[model samples]
Target: MNVYAQILIDEAKTRGITVKIIDEEANLYRLCYGNNSVLCRESLTEKTCAMAMTICDDKSLTHRILYKSGLRVPRQAIYINMTQAIDLMQTWNSLVIKPASGEQGRGITVDVREKEELQQAIKSASKYSEHILLEEFVHGRDLRIIVIDHKFVAAIERKPAFIIGDGASTIRQLVKKKNKALIQTTGGESQIPINTETERVIHHRNFSWEDVLPHEQELQVCKTANYHTGGTIIDVTDEVSYTLRTAAEKASHVLNIPVVGLDFLVPDFSGDDYVIIEANERPGLANHEPQPTAERFIDFLFPETKK
Candidate 1:
C-alpha cells in the first residue's frame, strides 16, 4: 500500500473502524465503523465535492477565483503557445512556468530569467499540460497550510534539496551520499535529481559537478521546494501566525473545500504579507508527521470517531 493509504488505514483502525483495500493499483480503499462507511481514493474521500476538486485542479481558474475573492495572489497569465509565453515573460525578468493542471511540482520550471530559458521552460511544461501558466516569480519561503473543515490543522515550510560540504568530495559524490540518506529518511519518496537542471544550478553558482565545495558551505541543488522532488519539509504548525492561518482558512471557505492545502509565498511566518500560490484539494497527509494531520483528517471524515 502507498504511504498515504497506510496512514489513513492505521488512523481508522485506531478508531476501531474496519479498513479494506478496494483497489490496490489505484490506492482505493474503504473504511467502515458500524453502519457508517466511506470510500476513499488516497486522501480524497467521497465527501470531497467534485466541483471543489475541479477548481483546485485548474491553476488558472484557481488564481482567477482567489484574485476575485479579494485574496492576495501573484500576477499570472495563461498561454497556449511559445509566442504568447515569451511575450508574457517580457513583463517580468524572472518568471515561474508550470502546467495548468499538474501536481507534485512536475513539469514546473522556476526562476526562469532569460528568453532561452523561458522557451525551454514552456516546452518542458507543455509535456504535462497543453495550457501553461507564467507567473511573476516571488521570492519567499514556501509554506504549506493544511486546512480541514475551514480550520488550520498543520503547516510546513519546504526547502529545496541542499548539501553541506566537508571539503573532501566533489558535488557529484556529495549528491550521491545525500540521496542515500534522503532515501532512508523519506522511504525513497524524495531524492535530488542529478540532471541538466542540477547542472545548470551548479554552473550558475560558478561551480561544476567535479568541483569540490568548501567545508561548512551549503549548496542548494534544486530550485523547486517540492517534497517529491528532493525537497525537505519542516513542520511549522506551531510557528504559523494567526494572520496566515486566517488567510488560509478564508481561502478554503471561499473555495468551498472541506479539506485543502494552501500553498503560500510568504516573506516570513510572523508577518501578514503573503501570496496564495495554489490550493490542493487532496493534500498529502503522510508527510506532516508529529503534527496530527492524519488524526485531523480522520476526525473530519468521521467526527463521531473523535475522542
Candidate 2:
C-alpha cells in the first residue's frame, strides 16, 4: 500500500471500523470494510472520495467549470509554451507559477514580481507540468478548508515549516537538526531540501551557515510556507468561522464536487473579503492528522453506518 492508503487503513482502525487489506499484486492492495470494498484505484485512489477528488486535481478543468458557476478562484492562465509564459509575465507584474496537476505545494513558486524572476519561476514550475498554472499571487494568510461529504470538516493554517534559531548553532546545523526531527515527526515520509534561497536568506541577514543562528524570536530564513518545504500546519478549526464555511460550501456546491480542498488567502476570516486561490483534489491527508481525514473519508463512504 502507498503511504496515503496506509494512512486510511490506520485511521479506519482508529475510528472502530474493521478493515482488511488484501494484496492484489506487489504494489496493489484492496481495502474491504464489512460489505463495502475499495480497491487500489488510482484517480489517486479508487474510492468514491478519490474519484470526486480527481475532479478537483486537474486544476485547468476544475477552474474552468467552477469559474462559470461563480466560484471564487484566482485569475489563472494556462500555458504550454515558454512564449506564452513570457507574454503573460509582461502583463502581470506579480504572479505565481504552479503545476497544473501538482500537490503539497511542490513545484509552486510565489511572488514572481519581475520579468527575469517570472521566467525562472515558470521554468521551474513547468518541469513538473506540461500545462502550467500562472496565477496572480494573492497576498494573505494561507487557509486550507477541507470538505468531506459536502460539509466542512476542519481547517488549518500551513505556516511554512521552518527551523527556529537558538542563537548558537549554525544555519546548516540548525537545518540538519530539524531535518532529523522532521523524519521522526512524519515517519520519514518527507525531508527538507537545502537550497540557495535558504542560503541567500541567511547571508542577507549577515549570517552564513557556519555563523551563529538568528535571534531566538526572529524569523531568519525562507518566506514560502509549504509543508514540502518544511512548513508547519496549525489547527485553526475555530478560526474558519461561519462566513468562511458558507463560502466554502457554496464553492463546493457550485463545482459539484463532493470532496475538495479549498485554499484561501485572507487577512481575516471574520472579514468579508478574501480570495479563493485554488481548490485541490487529493489533498494530502497526512497534513491534517489527529483529525483523521481518512476516517472522515471512510465515514463519508459509509454514511449508512451512521443511521
Candidate 3:
C-alpha cells in the first residue's frame, strides 16, 4: 500500500471508522463512519467530479482554464514539431518540456536553451505521451498548496534534491548514504536515483562522483523539485500569504473540485506575485506530514465525523 493510503487508513482507524481493503493492489479501500461510507482509491473519492478530474489531468487544459480565469500563469505553448519547439526556445531562451498529461514530475526536462537540448527533451517527454508542453522556465520557489472543500488546508515548499558535504566521503558514497536515509524516512517510497541526470547536474558544477566535496558545501543533485525525484518537502502552511491562499482557493472553486493541489512558482511566499504552474486532482495527502492533511481529507469526505 502507498504510504499515503496507509496514513489515511491509520487516521480513519483512530477516528473509530471501520476500514476494509477492497483492492490491495490498487490501494483501494472502503471506510465507514457510522452509516456514512466512502470508497477511496488513494486520496481520490467519489466526491471529486469526473469532469474536474479530467480537466486537471491535462496540463495544457489546466493552464488554459486557469489563465482564462484571470490567474497568473507562465507563458506556455503546445509542442507541435521540432521546428516550432525550437522557435519557442529561441524566443524564451530557457524552456521546460514535459508530457501534457503526466504527473509526479516524470519525463520532465527543465532549462532547455539549445535546439539539441529541446529535441532531446521532447524525445524524453514523448516516451510518456505524444502530447507535449513547452513553457518558458519560470524561476522561483516551488510551492504546493492543498485546497480541500474550497479552502486552503496546507502549503509546502519543495526544494531540489541536494547533498551536503561531510568532508570525508566521495560524492557517490554521499549519494548512497542519502538514498538510504531517504528510504528510511519515506518508508521506501522515495529515493534519489543515481543516473545520467544526477551525473549531468553534478558535471555542470565541475564535479564528479569520485570527487570529494568540502565540508559544509551544498550540492544540488537535481533541478526539478519533485518529491518522487528525491526533493525535500518543508511545511509552510503557517507562513503562506493570503494572496496565495486566496488564489489557490479561487482555482479550486473554478475547477469545482472538492479537493485539489495547486502548484505555483513564487518569488516570495509573502508576495502577491506568482505563476500557477499546474493543478493536481488527487494531491498526495501523505507528503504534508504532521500537518493533519489526511485528517482534513477524511473530514472533507465525512464532515459528520467532525466535532
Candidate 4:
C-alpha cells in the first residue's frame, strides 16, 4: 500500500472514524464517522472535482489556465516536432521537457542546454506521453504548498536528492546507503534510481559514480525535487510568505478545487517571486508530519468528525 493511504487510514482510526479497507490492493478505503462516510483512494477523495483533476493532470492546460488567470507560469509549449523543439530551445536557452500528463517526475528531463540534450529529452518524454511539454526551466528550489478546504494547511520546501560526502565512499556506495535508509523509511517509494538522468546530473557536476567525494561536501544528484524522485522536504508552513500563501489560494480558487498541492518554483520561500508549476490533486499528507494534513483532510471529508 502507498504510505500516503496508510497515513490517512491511521489518522482516521485515531480520530475515531471507522476505517474500512474496501480494496487493499488498490489502496481504496472507506472512512465512516457517524452517519457520514467518504471513499478514498490514497490521499485522493470524492471531494476533488473531475474537471479540476483533469486540468491539473495536464501540464500544458494547467500552465494555460494559471497563465490566463494572470498568475506567473513558465513559458510552455507542446512539442510537436524537432523543429518546434529546437525553436523553443533557442528561445528559452534552458528547458524542461516532460510528458504532458504524468506524476512523480517519471519522464521529466531538466536543464536541457543544447540541441543534442533536447533531442534526448524529447525522446524521454515521448516514452510516457505522446504530447510532450517543453517548459522554460526555471531556476529555483521546489516549494510545495498544500491547500485543503480552500485554506492553506502546509508548505514544504523540497531540495533535489543529494548525497553528502563521507570521504571514503564512492558515489555508488553512498547511493546504496541512501537507498537503504529510504526503503526502510518510505516503503520503497522514495529511493533514487540509478538511471541515465541520474548519471547526467552527476556528470553535469563533473563528478562520476566512481569518484570518492571529500567529506562534508554536498552534491545534488537530481534535477527534479519531487519526493518520489528522492528529494527531501522540510516543513515550511510558518516560513511561507503571506504573498505565496495568497497566490496558492488564488490558484485553487481559480481552479475551483477544494483540495490540492500546488507546486511552486521559487528562488526563496521568504521572497515574493515564483512560478507556479503544477497542481497535484492528491498531495502526500504523510510528508507533512505534525502539521495536521491528514487531520485536516479528514475534517474536510467529514466535518462532523471534527474533534
Number of the top TM-score candidate: 4
Model 4 lDDT per residue over 105-170, tens place: 899999998787788888888889889999998998789999999899999988889999999999
lDDT of 2 by residue, 3-113 (tens): 656776665566556665566233344556678765543113454454456667777777777677776667788876767766766677667788888776666767666
Q: Mind giving the per-residue lDDT tens digits that candidate 1 earns over 1-307?
A: 7897889899999999899889998889999988989999878888888889899999999999999999999999987676776776777767898999989888888888877787778888889998889998999999999998889999999998898898999999999999998899878878888876677678778999999999999999888899988898999989889999999999998899988899999999978999999999878888788888888888988999997
Per-model TM against the reference: 0.95, 0.81, 0.94, 0.96
Q: Between prediction 1 and prediction 4, which has the larger TM-score? A: 4
Model 2: clashing residue pairs?
Answer: 41-45, 41-46, 160-225, 160-231, 161-230, 161-231, 161-232
lDDT of 1: 0.88
* Deviation from truth (RMSD, Å), model 3: 1.6
lDDT per model, in order?
A: 0.88, 0.69, 0.89, 0.89
Off by over 4 Å in 4: none
C-alpha RMSD in Å of predicted model 4 compared with the true structure: 1.4
Off by over 4 Å in 3: none
lDDT per residue, candidate 3, 42-138, as tens digits?
Answer: 8888888889989998999999999999999999999888889888888988899989998888888878887766777788889898799999999
Candidate ranking under TM-score, highest first, comes to 4, 1, 3, 2
What's the CA error at residue 67 for candidate 4, in Å? 1.0
